[model samples]
Target: MSVFSARTGLAAALAVAALASGGCTQLRSHQGYVVDTDLVNSVQPGVDNRQSVLATLGKPTLAGQFDQGDWYYLARDSRNLAFRNPRPNAQITLQISFDQKGTVTAIRRGGLDQVASIKPYGKKTPTLGRERGFFQDLFGNIGTVGAAGAGGGAGNGSNTGGGGRDRP
Candidate 1:
């Protein structure tokens, strides 16, 4: 090849290499509260109350549903490459409990060891009770309804002329 053509070919190859490398790069993301170890460690039970924790760590990711005494701070770092599903690289679950008096009673921390993966068995969820087809479900109650003994409130078809009741 000529010198100018060789240079042009080398530049095109470099551009393609850069684009391919960019596609393989891992995409990193963060969700929920961003954790600071120093601030978290600074919180001491019996000393820090709800107000101080809120001021230090800001608002929690979630609070107790039934009772407002428990606070939960969740932080997760995830990464994925190309079309792959994102997987957790790191996770932090911080739970701070408070007594009825709103004083910090306990501080608990958890990591990825607490993560659980649940894969469903099939396309349709399994449920209890009999499985009926579409036609059966539509016409299953046809004969059962409006029948005399089926609590339809219609008297028997007797011809006693006493309104279907036996004479005394």
Candidate 2:
């Protein structure tokens, strides 16, 4: 075979291989805090306070929402193939509880087992009030605005006719 035809065949093979491998590639992502194993383990309860912990591990990913005493550091590594949702391969959730005096009281660690997946029921959220169609909603208040017992009537009820004074 001539060198030009051979090179064309080789280029076609490489192109096909590139397209095939593209779908097999794994995409990885990291979210939230970046953790250091030694630094996280180095934090000792009763010895480290909020300031010391901040200096050691930097700021936490999230702090206590309500109590303001607990700090949480989260690190997650997720991977996914083409056209697929990313799944967590590894996750670290470190919770450091502090006392009212801002001293570290306890340290807790969690993993992927703690992750919860929540799916909503449907596309449209169910509401409490009566369901009205397009025409009903558009013309729902047609006669209710100035009706007799509904107020705003013409000089009939005490609420509609009287202008800041009581009439006997």
Task: Indicate which candidate wins on TM-score.
Answer: 2
Regions of model 1 farther than 4 Å from truth: 127-168
Span of ten consecutive residues with least summed lDDT in model 1 = 151-160
Candidate 2 is scored at a TM of: 0.75
Q: Give the alpha-carbon lDDT of every model.
A: 0.90, 0.90
Candidate 1 local lDDT, residue 37: 91
Runs in model 2 with CA error above 4 Å?
Answer: 1-17, 20-24, 128-130, 152-168
Q: Residue by residue across 10-47, what tens digits does model 2's lDDT show? A: 99999999999988999999999988889999999999
**Least lDDT summed over 10 consecutive residues: which range in candidate 2?**
153-162
